[model samples]
Target: MSPTTLTDSSRVLCPETQSPQTARPKVTTVMVKTPRVAAISLDYVLYIESAKNGPLSRRQGLSPIKWEKIVPSPRPAPMEADIVSFTWPRFQTEAILHLANQRKALQAFLFKNLVEGNLLWLAYIKDHCDYGLAVQIHGATDFLNFSNAVYNAFPARVAVKITMDNLTHLAYEEAMRAHFQHHRQIAKAIKSIRVHASVTSLTSLTVVHPDHPQQVMEVLTKDLPEWAEAIVANHPKVTTRMPPQTTNFVWVDGRKRPTTHPLDAPPSKHNTGPEFTTPRNRTAATEPCSSPSDVDDIEVIQISSGTAATSNHTKPMAPASPELESHHMETYIHVAHIHKGDKLTWARLLNHGIVHWLFFRSSSKVELIGLGFPIGIA
Candidate 1:
């Protein structure tokens, strides 16, 4: 015969002890390996077992009794909210507007895309903090004003793609053909509004999708050859050339300067190291420290763009000139794309910028085919 199926059941009963410390409800679990028999009283036997271990000792074949304290389950923690909202900074948007206004091909791309309905504009404002890039999503429903949309979104400093072949794209192409027939010279027509009249010529203005890695690398190779070479060689130090005027675009290992010696000599003491010129005053002298007490007699010479320190005994160093200040300031190259999208949110855009997204699209409604950001050449 097959082994009898065993089942376990538990029930709580009032405490038999009058002691307040032992007043917790008694719990008894029954493990019955055999079918119910009329000769045995299961409830009475369980009650006797719960009161003491005497019943277990008396019953020749009874299972040993066990006592366990009940523990409550813990509640789960709350989840974080995914949605976040923010306004696109005005300066970044302004830079994009400037690029669109300056470049005919860019304006035409924006115009044609705006007319078609779906546009995804992505831009990397190199100056916009350390954040990488931001993408603005526009659906067909909000194509009323092209320039306004661009200023609200951003410009294309990297690459722009047109993925639609619908009536709008065709109409724009036909208009471009008529302009080409009228002007004859492609160069002259490209300089005017006719530049935006066609979507066919956009390839020349910006790198097309699926062709970014090669094109972006080509631009980087030409503009910042040292960086490109270092990236390919996987070298820590790039000794061939100085970094571009822009700093912090990417980390170049072994670029950290050696610890500088303190240059905190009193006004009377002269610097023995190389003499550096102050850009503002055209005087040659070593840089000073904010606090003289920090350093002993050692010299501390710093090479950076900032306001010079002042001393009660020594005259204040000249401030940076306007041109120098502007040169040190951050500049950016933005890349814009035209694509399809529906639901868009500010949180999604912020997240896109934060994650250093190489080539990923989060919008469920949009398909990103091409993206390009040419390394900005000063």
Candidate 2:
């Protein structure tokens, strides 16, 4: 909406320049020149606001989509302390981050999100804020000129001075992780990089295994282009393996097992027996033999295996209702990794549970599956 408009058609006394009698007469039609300001759509405004926060982390009380829908858009809040809604970036970063951390990211976020344009004019309109950050960014563009003059000219890759002291020892683990993370940072530096790292533009990724530098070099040189692998030959031939990482064990049905898989699910193994030991109190007791004959048969059957074992034995609980379990199993089963939708469905705890169990198992979730004996509610 135009906050202000000038209409020459309205009969009004001019200030000191003209008295009431000298007022301009109403005309049949009046022409007014509207400044050709680049009008941004509401979508662009929200994009600018959301860009301040990092990628959608489930840090805000609401997810990215919910935050966008529920949180107020960049238009000023209706009232102070009114608490109607909050957008992701505003609520997560600007509203909560420490002043120092917030300042480091700064109003530069606004300019960074903006495309080619005169920022000053835009900032002039959004003059009020917790900080005059947006306006300051527009002011800085004249002097900083970061997008066009500074960043574009920088080299895509900087050669690391790879050395034995840095790449080979336990002390160097942090440095190596940092080195890997440094490469990750470059990918996030630009939108194109963040979406996908182009092999041509990416720096030769140096993999220096202290003891196996030669092997590391061989693999990289073979997989990567000559320009990307130039430093491989010069890298010191070393004699050390990567420091071993401390292993974490996951508890399932109460048994603890060292987990190697990304999802922490153990490889399936054959049980070859009617019953298996159950960990106490954590999961339902191991399912028993379906038939009395199977109890004596001792036939080989494949079942998921885990590491830890206990001496106690018990009968697994039979399904509360097989049809109900089947319905739940068929529905609400998410093949994908944890997503907002999966979380929403899982939180409801619908009567059907087999699908929920399958989802938890598939997702490698141990805690939220609720496999233990059901608790009675008052």
lDDT of 1 by residue, 1-378 (tens): 335643443222445744455566889988532221111000000112223433223345556443211111231122111111113333223323433545564445445544555333432322333213443335322222322333333331222122223434456698899876654443332333222222222231221113222211011322333333343444564322222233432222222222211123232232222234455534333337435654453443453433243232544345332222221101110223422231242233343331222112121111121111122210
Per-residue error for 285 in candidate 1, Å, reads 99
- Candidates in order have lDDT scores of 0.30, 0.29
For each candidate, what TM-score against the reference? 0.12, 0.13
The Cα error of candidate 2 at residue 308, in Å, is: 85
Clashes of 2: 5
**Candidate 2 lDDT by residue in tens digits, 290-312:** 56655554433333543233323
lDDT of 2 at 25: 72
Q: How well does candidate 2 match the true structure in TM-score terms?
A: 0.13
Worst 10 residues of 2 by lDDT: 157-166
